[model samples]
Target: MAAPDKAQQLEEAAKAAEHAAQTAEAAAANASGNAEAATAAAEHARMIADQLAVIASASPISDFVFLLTIFMLAIFVGYYVVWSVTPALHTPLMAVTNAISSVVIVGALIALGADLSQSANSFAPKLFGFLAVALASVNIFGGFLVTQRMLAMYKKKER
Candidate 1:
C-alpha cells in the first residue's frame, strides 16, 4: 500500500526466503545421507548374494549336474570325432558311424530298458544287441585287423 510499508514487507519476504532455503538445504543433506546409507546396504546385499552364489555353485548338486552335462557333451563330441576323423571308413563312413551310434544307443537303451525276452529286470537283450552289432562291425570293416597290422608294423620297426 504505502512505499515504506511495501519495503518492510519485501524485507520480511527475503528473510522468509532465506529460512526456506536453509530448510531445503537441511532436507537435501538428510536425503543425501539416506541415499548413501541405502547404497551401502545395497552393496552389502550384493556381497551376500555373490557369496551365496559361490557356495551354491560349488555345492554337490550343482557340481554333479555340471559334471554330468560335461560328460554328455564329451560323448557327443566323441561321436562327432569318430564320424569325421577316420579316413579308412571311406565311402559309407556316415552309414557305418550311424550303425555304430545305433548300437551304442541300443546298449544305453538296454541299460534303461524294461527287460524283454529275459528276466523282467534284465538288460540282456540290449547288451546282446549292441555286442552283436559291434562284433559284426569289426568283421565287416576290419578295423581291428587294420589297427593290429599298424601295431605290428610299429613293433617290427621298433625291434
Candidate 2:
C-alpha cells in the first residue's frame, strides 16, 4: 500500500510539470509574436519619417514657386485694374495711390526703426526699408504733381 501511494504522488508531480511546460511554451510563442509586431511597426514609422524628410528637403523650392506665381498674378491684375479706370477718375486714383504710398512710408519707417541688435541679419531689413522710404517718397511727390496737373486741366481759363 505504501509503494502505491508513492507512485501516485510521483504521477501527480509529473502531470503538474507537464502543464507548466506547456504554459511556458505558449507564453514564449506570444512573446515572439509581439516582438514581430513591434518590428513591423518600427519599420512603418521609419518609412514615414523618410517620406517627411524628403518633403522637408523640397519645401523651400516649392514655397518660392508658390510665391512667384502669386506675384505674377498680382502684376497682371494690377495692370488690368489701372488700364480699366476712366480718364476722369485718374486724379482721384492718383490721390488714393499717394495715400497708399504714405502707408508704405510708415511701414518702411517702422522697419527702419526696428532694433538691429537682436538679429544677425538685420542689415537687409534696414537697407530695404531705406529703399522703400526713398521710392515711396518719390511716388507720393510724383503722384501729387500729377494730380495737380490733372486738376488744372479742369479749371476754367481766365480771359
Candidate 3:
C-alpha cells in the first residue's frame, strides 16, 4: 500500500480533534440542563415540605371556640342549679359552700407566697391572690353568721 501523504494525515487529525471537541461540548450542555432540572425539583420538594410543616404546627381557632362554648355552658348550668335551692336549706348549703371556698383560699395563699422576691416586681398575680383570699374569708364569716341566725330561730321557747 502507498504511504499516506503528510498533509492529508494532518488534515484528518485536525478534523478528528474538532469532532471530539464538539461532542464534549454537547455532552456538557446536556449535563448542565439535567443539573438545573434536578435543582428545580429539589426546591419544589422543599417548598412542599415547608408548607406541610406549617399546616401541622398551626392550631385551629374553631377548637378554641368549642372549648370556650363548653366552659360557658357549664357555668350557666351551675348558676341555675344553685338558684334552685330551698330557703330552709340555704344556711346548711352556704356552710358547705364556705368549706369548699376554703380550698380556694389556700391555693390563693400559695400563689401569693411563691417566689416572694418576684412579688414586688410582678404585682398582678399577687393582687389576684390577695383578692381571692379576702373574698373567701368574707364568704366563710358570712356563712357562719347566717347559720347561727337560722339555728336561733329554731330554738324552743321557754314556758
Query: Which is the better candidate, 1 or 3, if ranked by TM-score?
Result: 3
Error of 1 at 37 (Å): 1.1
List ranges where model 3 is wrong by over 4 Å: 1-71, 116-121
Tens-place lDDT digits, model 3, residues 54-93: 6555855465664565456556555654555545556767
* Alpha carbon lDDT of each predicted model: 0.60, 0.80, 0.73
Worst 10 residues of 3 by lDDT: 80-89
Off by over 4 Å in 2: 1-62
Off by over 4 Å in 1: 61-159
Cα deviation at 125, candidate 1, in Å, is 40
Candidate that would win on lDDT: 2
Task: Give one digit per residue, the lDDT tens place, for model 2 in 137-157.
Answer: 999999999999999999999
For candidate 1, write residues 12-42 as lDDT tens digits.
9999999999988876676566556656655
TM-score for each candidate, following the candidate numbering? 0.36, 0.60, 0.51
